[model samples]
Target chain A: MGRVVVEVMPKPEILDPQGKAVVGALPRLGFTQFTSVRQGKRFELEVDGPVTPEVLAAAEEAAVKVLSNPVIEDVVRVADIEADAAATITSEGLA
Target chain B: MGRVVVEVMPKPEILDPQGKAVVGALPRLGFTQFTSVRQGKRFELEVDGPVTPEVLAAAEEAAVKVLSNPVIEDVVRVADIEADAAATITSEGLA
Candidate 1:
């Protein structure tokens, strides 16, 4: 199986009030060195086969269409990881 | 100021108990297709200047050293962002 890592972030030039609030809350959360917080989500899916480029692209498109808000969100990064080496190496070689 | 985005993930080889639990909970959480969850953390820093390669590398190192568990955690990815064009372009050129 392969895993896709999607990184969702606020668009540049926009102010992140939630991020600011989280940053402000850090010191109280027992982290004195915590200067800021960038809120995002992490998801792992057990898809069939290895991390083919097509699979990675599809997952990311799915993430954007279903999981994220386009207006506020910036680009979503897709990292495809295959659990099994034999399939993964073959997929990578094809790519 | 620039924003540094840090992504932390569990080690690939290790079994993720939390991930399993989260995956089990997804259907109940209104996600019929939601298969799994790999938890991670995100941090944003208001660094001076643009996204120089050195700064991004340093942030990743700091994240590994201070914020993550070496035994269980795998790798930390750092992305540096500069607000102003004047600084970021120069830094990118340098990299």
Candidate 2:
């Protein structure tokens, strides 16, 4: 199987309260070197076969339609992963 | 300045309702090749300098403490981006 990774992030004009909270909490936690923090969403979809152009297109459509709210958010990145090799086991599982 | 990207995902043992909803919606949307979907969080932190090892460590700590609930989620990946180069402009901005 192949895997498609889609990243969804809020538009720059939108206010991200969760991200703002994290940014606000940082200084209280004693780390104050950051200028800004933007939080978003990531979706990992495992397909039934090797990733192809058609799959990517379909995934993109799904990501735009189902994964994010286009009014306030956008799809930032879409990546293909080889399930047979790099995806069967979690990287943390190895550790 | 530099940037750090942190990806936070639910632990394998934890339940992901948002992911489940997406998986359920895909078939209705005419795309049904996925076995599963896992939704997660991504944080893009813009720092004021180059991303050093210390910066990565601090970002990791913040990701763990402020960004995710360690009881149910985990940090999957931590990436460093160069602010002076590719990070200066959005890839979509060129379009």
Candidate 3:
């Protein structure tokens, strides 16, 4: 199976109450280095075969049209999961 | 300023009703290639200076301790936003 990852974030001008809440809470939790926080959404989509360009195109279209609200959010990324390996931490390692 | 991006996902064994709803809705929206979908959270933490190793480490700690629930979610990634430039689509480009 192949997987595509999509990331969406709120527009810079938008007010993110959730992020504000997190930033407010972090200092109390002793993580005081962060000055601000912005919360967003990540999605993983699975397909039966390799992630072809056609699949990526479809995913991108879906990301913009269905996965995010253009008025408030931006489709920041749409890519094959393999391309994200360097950044992804497997749950086993954390376990 | 520097930004750290953190991604958190629902554990594979966990029931992701939001993902299921998306997967079900996709076909209706004419996106049929995807077989499954998993929804997750992405956070961007901002700091006043360049992202040092110490900042990255702190973000990772916050990702696990405050951003994610170990029982149902996995802290999949915690990286400098610069490292994500290749995948990130600036809103201006989309516009």
Candidate 4:
């Protein structure tokens, strides 16, 4: 099977209370260098086989239509994680 | 400024009802090739300087202690997004 990952983030103009709360809590917990925090959703879809372009396209469509409320959010990234092994090996040179 | 992204996902044994709902809805919505879905949280932190190792470590600690319920979920990925530009250039070669 393959995995398609989608990241759904709130629109820049939207007020993310959860993010604000986290940001507020950070300083109290001694993480003072941080400036802002934005919280979002990630969905990992497992398909029956290697993730193809069609699977990505459909997943993107699903992310936009059902995974997030488009009026206030954005689907920022859609990645075919099945290809990650090659990319990781190229970047980290891990065998 | 720089950004650090933390991905929090449910443990393998945990039942993700929200993900299940999405998987169930996909077929009804005409996306049948997908077999499973796992939902998670993504946190984007905007820091005051370049995302250094210290910042990443603190963010990782925060992710483990506050961002996710350790008893139920896992912090799967902690990324220095400031370094993404270099990686993207290497991979996609976008100027």
Error of 4 at A93 (Å): 9.1
- Write down the C-alpha DockQ for each prediction: 0.16, 0.39, 0.40, 0.51
lDDT by residue (tens digit), candidate 1, A1-95:
55666556777666888668756754554444445566665556666556566665566665676545788876445554322223333322332
Task: Pick the TM-score winner.
Answer: 3
TM-score of each: 0.51, 0.83, 0.91, 0.89
Candidate 4 per-residue C-alpha lDDT over B1-95 given as tens digits, one digit per residue, 9 for 90 to 100: 98988889999899999999999999998989889999999999999877777888898899998889999999977777645424434432211
For residues B1-95, write the lDDT of model 2, one tens digit per residue: 87888888899899999899889999998988888999999899989877877887899888888888999998877667443123223322321
Clashing pairs in 4: none
> Deviation in angstroms for A14 in model 3?
0.8
Candidate 1 residues lying further than 4 Å off, grouped into runs, are: A8-39, A50-95, B13-15, B28-36, B81-95
Ranking by lDDT: 3, 4, 2, 1
In the range B1-95, model 1's lDDT, one tens digit per residue, is 55666666788777878678756764654444445567665556655565555655556665676556788885545554322223333322332
- Fnat of the models, one by one? 0.22, 0.65, 0.60, 0.61
Clashes per candidate, residues 3 or more apart or on different chains: 0, 0, 0, 0
For candidate 3, lDDT tens digit of each residue in B1-95? Answer: 99999999999999999999999999999999999999999999999998888898999999999999999999988878875663333321332
Candidate that would win on DockQ:
4
Q: lDDT by residue for model 2 over A14-93, one digit each (tens)?
A: 99998898889899998798889999998889888777778878888998888889999999776674432132233223
Residue lDDT tens for model 3, A1-89: 98999999999999999999999999999999999999999999999998888898999999998899999999888877875663333
Model 2, position B88: C-alpha lDDT score: 20
